[model samples]
Target chain A: MKIFELGKAKSPWILHYNTGSCNGCDIELLAVLTPRYDVERFGMLNKGNPKQADILLITGPVTKRCRERLLNLYLQVPEPKVVVAVGTCSCGGGVFRHMYNVENGVERVIPVDVYVPGCAARPQQIIDGVVKALQILREKGRALEVPPHLKKIVRGREGGIDRESLLEDLRRR
Target chain B: MKKIKVNQEICTTIPMGSQHVALPEPVKLVFDTENEVVKRVSFDVSYVHRGIEKSLTTMYDFKKAPYVVGRICGICAIAHSIACTVALERSIGIDGEVPDRVRAVRMIGLELDRLQSHFLINGHLAEVCGYENIFMHLWRCREFILDTADMLFGNRVQYDVVCVGGVNRDIDEKTGTRISEALEEIEESIGFMEEVFTRDKTLVKRLEGLGVVSKDKAFEYGLVGPSARASGVKTDCRIEDDWGMYRDFGLEIITMTEGDALARCLVRVLECFESVRMIREALDSTSPGEEIQLRVRDNPKKDAVCRNEAPRGELFYYIRGTGKKIPGRVKIRTPTFANIPILPHVMIGVRYNDVPPLLMSFDPCLSCTGR
Candidate 1:
């Protein structure tokens, strides 16, 4: 891991966007970040703008209207960022699954690095999910850090990106 | 200073939300301003609509409907759950037979839910007013109420404790004692916050006389909950309906006549004390030996309406059941649905930067509105 990867883990500024689920998961996320649970202890800052975000925490099952806004927000966060879906609804639509207006999970629109499952995912589970996201960031940080010639070689893998060994190494980390 | 009317011809428009710092949910408000003062305003509130009507009536079973209805708004899940359950029970004609103990427990859940919600909105009002420290303080104080909820119901955000005929969780002696103790601790902080919110010159200056919705205007919008009471309308659904044991506990309606943001804040703060009083009396009077869940065997064959005082205002649910496992029609008109329309009515004369606090003062919950 690059030395800067330590800084990334220590002070990850996170951006939160709600797609359309009932606010159960969103309030839990805010509670976990408060002084009582304090997600800041893990170096998380809940930034409002996507451009400054290093990790994106999204709640809600993507709805028809929010899908475009969700995709736009995901794109706005500069790369080396990892997406964490923070509730059961965001993971696979939970109670809202098969509803007419719901588009289901965030993964249907954008890649999710971690899925935190619960009706309104608990604060402890949210902290655990966020820690997992930081590990994914460390791997992406190193891969994106390589020079243009080496980056092209890494990006040319069979799946269009090299993450096969990185997953295994992350489990160990 | 002499009164001057700015020309509307040189106005510039500004659009806020769908996603913005001041809003937690998606909503768009376009303001047509003549320089700094807003001349005209419009709102778009359909962004959070997720086909709740379909889910409530067709997708979920009649018995499981309360849990589904609970998802309408995370902050006010208990209120929705209770309202939907009562409506279903009324249509089926079995709520009168529900045990008093179950109603008492349900009241505890409602009051605790009300306490936390009042804290959430009051603190967010402070946040939008740029008083981050007070926001933190109020929310930090709110954790006590949340912990009390976790003790009684199991989770913090969505309690999911309300069922069709009764409640899901039964309170033990141990938990009941703890709940009262937690409320005592919260009461101390509530006093301090009342002092802070009342005496803080900055908050008073920012909120006073801003977003003045007159009693007539409040009635014009059909405003519900604390919003209506703040406008000098002494109406509360809890007193109007005999759903819970509020009548037995002697729950008095609280109101103010100022019809401004500060009045709304003061009304909510005073009501929190009223809620605490009810909870304390309820814990003292009710013994915990009754059955929590009643076996409700009948299905609905008629239409019924249930109204409850959500922390924000009156939450009304209309359910039509046709003796089938699925409901025939379900219509949920949330408090925010009635309250958001009042935005354009009130914001037409306020300054631009005052928009966030004014909007927050109404406690806009777009998810509740659109759903």
Candidate 2:
């Protein structure tokens, strides 16, 4: 019934979160926005506030210190948000996989829509991941009557997956 | 004089790492504090220490050493590889004169690194200042420099351009012309950034004299790069060693006398200007010639130490080859190590509010420090 949702889905702003891996993926993620690759052509904007973002491009393996903050950030992004785990570290804890401190991959921390793999994940791969995420977002938005349990998971009070509870948590304790 | 005391009974000591909020890498910094103002800060840094030096010795052959060492510092991998390869070449006495074109490409990679690293640290410093907008702006500007690097080299961080003898890729006329145009825009952007940095009264107020390590003390602590230069020391490994194409194509090192966070920031800004000059000179003077790379010797036996002025400070790489598949030993003394030793001394009396900026002033990449 939403007539205007498709236009917004076409141009999804991104919020990049770095957990703990080497900064290689961060640099390559940046390269996607640069003139050469120019992922902005696909209507990607790097937004600072997670609340305003449509896609989350996570570039590192989640760490103990950053896990809570990362989860809080992911929850803040409104419904139909997609998570794109870019880089080997984020997809699966790359070289630092063995480290005791690394909490696991980005998916373990938050649900991931697209997984882009590379030691540092090339700019092209990152762009491809974003495109895939946008497609997933559109598909999810068009879905009809979700079952009751799925509704609770997506928009719920007890499960705490809803936006308002997440916002409340974002405020410093 | 007023003094604060720590109550060991009721106080909970936060064992903040092998990892902390400011660091991506694991390095333990034990804090004994009543609250946020750390009464005492002590740390242990062997967490991520993979015995990289030993690994370097056993894992890589001589030709493969540069790329392996490039993984040393993710941010400054280009400098690590360049310094190591240049040293290895010198040790084996392979006088593969770097063509002006290769020098230009190398300079582009190096300067772009300097631009990105400086902006990154400065943005992080702004975060300490609680100026998030400026932090975003600085980081956004850094993207342009990243794009420039990606265009020149295939990868953004690990360019993998520098081979044993010379640079791997050549700057074709179209790419070169495009890069020249990009540099013009980058310079203008930098000029705009300078205006913003200098005019931001709040930033200056917070950063000014916060972490003032005077010239004499800076020299005493053996700080290098802009950290040393900001203290009025004329010592730079680049000028002193005259390695790489620097001797042939001269460079002017930027320096200052304040030795504070502001002065260090100023040193980086001035150095960007210097880097721009060097890049311009290298580009203008470049002449197309023979192959950019020279054939590596089949098997070589030698031990060499090379030092370069990485964006952080002086990066020293020591390599010993046993004429085997792997290097005998590879030792790295990164800038953070040299700068970190001076931290406890500088932090002795500054207010608790000042510690973060002081840490940022040194541009401590804890990953590089621990690695």
- Provide the TM-score for each candidate, comma-separated: 0.93, 0.76
Q: Write the per-residue lDDT of candidate 2 for residues B115-170, one digit (tens) a residue.
A: 88887778778877788777667777777777788888876677888877788888
Model 1, B100-208: lDDT tens per residue? 8888888889999999998988988998899988888888999999888888899888899998888887899999888878988999988978997789999999999
Model 1 bad stretches (over 4 Å): A1-6, A147-173, B1-8
Best by lDDT: 1
lDDT at position B20, candidate 2: 35
Taken over the whole model, the C-alpha lDDT of each candidate is: 0.86, 0.73
Model 2 segments beyond 4 Å from truth? A1-20, A27-85, A89-113, A122-173, B1-28, B34-37, B44-51, B95-101
Q: What's each prediction's clash count?
A: 2, 4
Screening candidate 2 with a backbone cut-off below 3 angstroms (N, C-alpha, C), the clashing residue pairs are: B17-B28, B18-B26, B18-B27, B18-B28
Q: For model 1, which pairs clash?
A: B224-B313, B225-B313
Give per-residue lDDT, candidate 1, residue A67.
91
